[model samples]
Target chain A: MLDQAFETLKTYDWGTDRNLLNPIDEAIVASQADPAARRGLEGRLVAVLKTDVTRAAKDFVCRALMILGTADSVPALAALLAEPEQSHMARYALERITAPEAAQAMRDALPKLDGQMKIGVIGSLGARRDVASVPALAALLGDTDTAIARSAALALGAIGTPAAAKALMRTKPTSAEAASAVTDAALDCAEGLLAAGKSVEALAVYKRFAGEDQPKHVRLAATRGMLACAGK
Target chain B: MNPSTRKISRRRFLEGSAAGISAFSIVPRHVLGMGQTPPSEELGGALIGCGGQGPGTVGGMGSGIRMIAFCDVDRRRVENAAKRFGAKDVYTDFRKLLERPDIDVVAIATHPGWHPLTSIAAMEAGKDVLCEKPMSRFIAEGRAVVEAAKRYGRIFQIGTYGRFNASRDPKQILIHKIMASGLLKECQAVHIKRGGLKVAEWSGMVRYEVSDPGDREWDLYCGPAPLRPFHAHRFGGTHRGYWDYEGGGLADMAQHHFDPINWVYAKDATSPVQVEASAPPAHPEACGMWGWVELRYADGLTFVMDSDEWGDRYDRQTERDVRLEDLSPIDQQKIREMPDPEPLVGFAEAVKTRQQPGGHAEAAHRTATLMHLANIAIRTGRKITYDPKKEQILGDAEANRLVNQPMRAPWRVV
Candidate 1:
């Protein structure tokens, strides 16, 4: 049944009855308790990805990998990260895989891609909250493209490490978009720092924007953060 | 006249004149020329997602609201709604609409995916919000919305009034008092909401052809959610069917059912400590039918949501209401002596007075978290042990990932 399902999935496309792939679904459920079974299934799914399958078929495989894929599946998924049609789903799987190599794959792809693809990979790195990628993401904070720069700032903010916070604080925004993203990222960093029990560091982040020079709402958020850090 | 003395006299004269006009007018004030509300009294309102429940939500805000702007990813929806509501401004992007200084209140009737982002942006722009429910796509987004409301000091009300009605019910008030008094250490009550979840109706179509998104900013419509090929089912009310945008009918209807339950159980401030579900493996992109989900709070309160759309109904626990007998005699007497909880302020009043509404951000987030947790349990096909204070899934990295799912590029909730 599993072999037949793989054959059916090889030709799968939109508008096809998904129930035809029920065998794969059953395998996923059955493998939940067996780590060896999960790895075997992941290998089969990755094998299918290496084939010349339809985009929809690869999409299904990636979705399964999102649940079952480990480091062994990263290289196959990473190979698709630069392809426009497949990159989003590839990132979707890699973003959730709790493997350091997955984040590394995305970081490696960062400089090689541009436009939305690069932005997507940046987002994947941020979503993974990869501390190692902070320096790389911080480098793009000064990118000429407003969207890339804004995404970089927000990604650093998502990372919310003291290093990421320092990176955001060092760069001056070139556009209003970047400015807003910076303030928002700073607030996020402050909140994250406060949550991690580094109140003094959180207070410094908060105090950066608590001045009258900032917008009223930003000032308000900063003041609130400062008060929280003060244990008020 | 001196400035202070003249100011007092002018206020008295204006008050007397207003009173005299009201005393003599036989016709309705709106019918008379006096019906035109002053600028200070009228709220400038904007509506996002002008299809589905958008117009109805704005219309419910009463006549004191002036519909000034309308925004939707679909141009047709925005234009049609703007024309219907006499709004002069329409936009395909909400960021532009949020820039309008005149918009005092924003009614967000977008899909669950856009709820948190739009609500947070609106609050940060200094506008009060009446956001459509299932207040968030996941637990972390809901928490972000709550923090944004507090940080910006904005009035936020999820579009559910069950809690307000529950607050007025005498029986519910007693239950609330008993549960909230902190005197009852262990609550053995069980709540079961059976059927009416539209589980089958909203089960996602796993097979659909890609369709053109005509006159719709497809990318913007997919904001925060994954950028998938445009399918008609992935748009409009049916968007509830997809896991990318929502958690099927459970997310669509659970807030309506659970908001009041949360209030009565005094569970608004926290979440369930354990959640388990019985269902077939869920599709990664599409939502599927589920048999039941059982959520247990740390204090022994169990909430069983039986879909009744799939297999036999959940029979593990019988319905048990909280009663005086559940408490000790001394606790019962103390409950009797306790005053009834205060009446909850509604959205409109909250906006006007700058007070928290009955379904405020924290309460709404907790209610929405129930649906997210249940869906997570169903998707993972496992029992989930959770830390409510930390809002993390214990020993399950994959389940914890679902709690704070990643957003697509340029859309960070943090």
Candidate 2:
């Protein structure tokens, strides 16, 4: 099914390629059983994706992204993820891979992604429940891309680790979303940490998102998270 | 039209006559027949929307055409533009400016809200128009503008400017040319990245601030949008954030990125499948524009259009923040080898020959539709369906309503 779709994409004309995009996508999503054939087709699809050639090439590149995103095709997908040559499309495909292996691969390769790709990788970790990645995720709080730092906070919350919660509390918020997400993560992290008898860390974690210098909403939420965790 | 008495030099006239008198005689008398073209009949130009885009366009154009008139709601812009361009007349009202018989071309660089109405009005007034990118704020208005141009037989060009962007740099042009030549065996994907810096705050060169008291003219600026506060920044002010006026950066810049893609594609298509926007939410200082929007085309192709919120690395490296550079030299040389003609030059040439402009209303509408769809999909947090042929929304009824907007009371494009 994937081969037929790519063949159709190959023959598809530039201007009207939008018509063929849906079926090709359907075939990709529907082709579950044949992993090897799907891998071969996906490779062909990726090859067409990188060129600055026709709009079709660009369009095909994006479609290839969706295919690479599938969870089952781990090794081939990981190979693409690790290859810097296809970094642009690799970033797009990273978000699609939801499995633990894919998440671990992305996390292991996290330091390698540029600021932009780092954000995508962080989001993937948050989605994949990578609790063991708390330290790496915590370190990204200072990522050049504020969005990446914010995503790291969210990933910590998803991981639900005490150390992650403590880290979120210490981090300064930039954008409203980043601040809000950090506050939520810090609160959740405080509760988890306090329950584990990590009071000092919890208090510190609770202060950043809720402190007087922070916005009223974040401050209130953090305070509440701290109080509830301390049984006050 | 005697060859000797005509303005054409005797030698050239004799040579032309020797070749084919009857064939050359059939040509329009004013064009090349007697060669006595009137200087006074030179093409004249006027500009509507004298704000940021308007003035910049004039400056970029240098002194190509005769600037005869200027129009804007603000007297200050009119005065400055007129003084700068030596326009014979300036008016706060556009209707009066359109009345000039000498003006053959009109540049509709007005706010996005007024684009459809102004362009349609200009065409109705018997003038060709060059409207800014994302030509219409709403779909119905775009359709109306297209109808008006067709009915009046007027020339219409949508200003995406990406066609001219790649032409500015040789190396980038070369890269594009190589890709165009199909020499690159297989390109897995191409990403068009722009800086993540807030455009509203970028240069600090232009300040857009909304005034305190609500002015009566606010309704005019709000033409097709719902009634809202008289935010000066939303209209002609310095802090023209995309949230209040346009669909943020995606609407403001996607046409630039999409132009090259459209050139490569032979068809006019809209997003038939759902597009996803995995972006951070809005910030107070900045509008809720995306870090970037990941658009999945119907063919399963995904286009990642970044708003400055994503990151500024690409912007720093390329030195094209708001402004764009053309394809690299390698791309340009490669493009030269391809069969496709240069799109913008095609339009300019057509202007001289009275032929249809490239990237015509339909093409502009298609690209604009994608931009709007991307914004809508991101805003709605859902994948929306778009049908290019009917030029209407599909499946998502609520999203369909967003496809067109009702004009503010009394400011009708029809």
Candidate 3:
């Protein structure tokens, strides 16, 4: 039954009947309780990626891996991370995979990709809260492309470490878009710090923006953060 | 008349005319005072996602609000809504609309995927929000929206009003009091919400051709969700069918039913400890039909949602209502002496008084969590053991990951 489903998947494309993939779906559900069954299913799914399947077929497999894939499946998924048509779907699966190697694969792809592809990889890194990639992400804060720089700033904010906060505080944005991203990211770091019980550190981050020169809304957020840090 | 006295009277008349004109302009009521806004003092308002529900949400805000802006990913929707509301400002991007300081209130009827980001951004910009329900796309996003409301001192109300109606019911108030008193250590009550979940109606289209989203910012519309090829089914109201944007009909309609149930059961502050569902394995992208879901709270209360749209009916728990008999005799006596719960504040009143609304952020988050947890169970095809306090799934890393699903980058909830 699984072989028949895989054969159907190989020809699957947009506008094709999805019911043809039902056997695979049934297997995924049936294998949830049996670890051996799950690993077996994962192996079969990963094997399909190495073949010349349709984009829709690969998309379906990646979605399944999001729920069932383990470290053993990472290499096949990571291989697609630099392919423009496949990268987002690959990240969709890798972002949810809890294995450290999945994140490493994404960070490794950063230098090989650019444009929206690079931005997408940066996003996956941030989504994983990959602290190891912070310095690499911080370096992109000054990239000439505003969108890439903005994404990097937001990614750093999503990481929300003290180091991420310091990187944001030390840099001045050359573009309005990046400046807004920086403010949003700094606030995100402070909120994260406060939630982690580092009130003094959070206060320092907030105080950086709580000045008359800042926008009214920014000042308001900073004031709120300061008051929260003081336990008011 | 003397020349000097006549000139002074003319100046006074001009000042009074200016005040009358200003009364019709957009000034937030809170800035005026804590008192009810005068009939003439119109609050500035904006509508996001100006599709089928956006204009309706704006109209529902009562005549005290003057529509100032209309925003939608689709230019056609934005243009249509702007013309209908006589709004001079229209934008395809919500971020630009949110920047207007004069927009005292924002009515968000966007897809659930955009709910948390738009709500949080609006709150941070110092505008009160009336967001459409189910309050978030995921559990963590809902909690973030709640925190932003508190952090920024903003008023937030989910679109559903069932809890307001429940708060007005005398019997419901009694059940609320009994449950909230926490004296009933063992609750054996069973509450069931049957049928009308629209499971089949909202089940997603599994196969559709990618099409152009004419005049729509397709990437912006995807927002925190993965950027997928644009298909008509994935746009507008039909967007409810996809997990990428929403949790299907259950998410589309659950809040209306669960909001009041959560209020009466005093489950607004916590969540069910275990959830099991009867359904086919859900499609990873498109939502599918589900038979039923049984959620159990730690206190022995069972809340069952039977989607009469599929399979066998859920008959494990007899249909019944909470009774005084469900509580211990001592606890019953204590509840009888307790006062009725306070009447819930309406959104408009809450916005004026700076008080929490009936369907405030925390309660909305809890209600939305019930739907999310049920969907999680259906998708995983397993019984989920959850920790209500920590908001994590026990002994299951994959299931726990659903509780705080990662948003696509540049859109972190934390």
DockQ for the candidates, in order: 0.20, 0.01, 0.23
| CAPRI band for model 1 | incorrect
Ranking by DockQ: 3, 1, 2
Q: What is model 1's DockQ versus the real complex?
A: 0.20
**Which tens-of-lDDT digit does each residue in B1-414 have in candidate 3?**
111222222223223332343244435556776555565566899999888778878765655788889999888889999999887799988889887878989999999999999998898777889998889988877877876675455778988888888888888988888789888788878889999898998885764677877878998889878766788888888999888899998898898899999999999878999999999878767899999999999998889989999999999988666788877788788888988888888777666556668888879988999999999998888899987755668888777667766555456564
Candidate with best lDDT:
1
What share of the reference contacts survives in each candidate?
A: 0.29, 0.00, 0.26
- TM-score of the candidate numbered 1? 0.90
Better of 1 and 2 by TM-score: 1
Best by DockQ: 3
In candidate 3, list every pair of residues with a backbone clash.
Answer: none
Please give, for residues A160-209, the per-residue lDDT of candidate 2 as tens digits.
56667667766776775466557656654554455555667767776655
Q: Write the per-residue lDDT of candidate 2 for residues B82-201, one digit (tens) a residue.
A: 888876598777878887778878887877878887887677566778887767765655765764554344577787666455544554455445444544443333345455424444
Q: Regarding DockQ, does 1 or 2 come out ahead?
A: 1
Model 3 Cα lDDT, one tens digit per residue, A73-185: 89999998878778777877888899999999888888888887788888778767789999999999999989889888888887878889889988889998788788878
DockQ of 2: 0.01
